[model samples]
Target: MTKKIVVLGVSGSGKSLIGKNIADKLDYPFFDGDDFHCQANVDKMRQGTPLTDEDRKDWLATLNTILTDNPTAVIACSGLKPEYRAMLRKGLDDITMIYLKGTIDTIWQRHQKRDGHYFNGREMLESQFATLVEPEKDEALVIDISQDASAVLNEALSLLSKK
Candidate 1:
């Protein structure tokens, strides 16, 4: 069976960084969910607007198709709501979710330093947290983001190895 991991979190919690590291370590293809968003969605978010569920359906479907196409891959996505995560889980097997859990303050600090991304500011981060339905204990391997990237990546790899 294919092995897939979804690295999920609010923006600036390091989903893309850690997901890329995990993918590189595992020799799996990496997909950034942001890259799948339509121009309209990008425009909205670039203007500091939060996306509605309706705006995300097609994007989620595209991620699902990417998952199906790349049997072994790591996906970086803001799988914020339970419904969004559930949408990604459809028609898949051997999939594991890793939530890069962090406090708003921690994420906000990182957010401030990030460059060249569409997600504009703390308002969007706040919106993401508001919308987030944290992955249940049984649904994901939750990793704290307080540690450095290497430590975080090592911890994730260690946990995933057992599965």
Candidate 2:
């Protein structure tokens, strides 16, 4: 069976970085969900405005289509809410959801260091956390982002191997 992986987390939680690493390791195509966003959504986020659920409908549908098209792909997405995650999982089965778990301070520091990203400021992070419904232990392999990238990637690889 083809493996479908979604590296999900709040903004600046290293979803893109970690997802890319996993995709390279697994030899699967990698996609950043941010890239699927419409120009209007990108503009709003670039202006430091948080997107509402309505603004994300088309973007989520696009990501879902990507998953449907490439069954063996790795995607980085801010699947913060349970509804959002559910939307992504609409048609797929056997998906591995990897949650990059981190504290607000840790992610905030990463956000501060990020350059040229549409997610402009730390102000939106709060809203992200507020909307987040953390994946249950049974539903995801939760990796602590406090660890170095290599260690986290190693752990993910090891855990995924067992599945």
Q: Kindly list the per-residue Cα lDDT of model 2 for residues 1-163, writing each as its tens digit.
A: 2399899999998899989999999999999999999999999988888999999888988988899998599999998888888889889987888999999999998888888888877778888888889999887889999999899899888888988
Listed per model in order, the count of residue pairs whose N, CA or C atoms clash below 3 Å is 0, 0
Q: Evaluate all candidate structures by whole-model CA lDDT and list the values in order.
A: 0.92, 0.89
After superposing candidate 1 on the true structure, give the runs of residues whose Cα lies further than 4 Å from its correct spot.
Answer: none
Q: Pairs clashing in candidate 1?
A: none
Model 2: worst 10 consecutive residues (lDDT sum): 1-10
Candidate 2 residue 140 Cα shift, in angstroms, is: 1.4
lDDT of 1 by residue, 1-163 (tens): 2399999999999999999999998899999999999999999999999999999999999998988888698999999988999899999978999999999999999988988999988899899999999999799899999999999999999999988
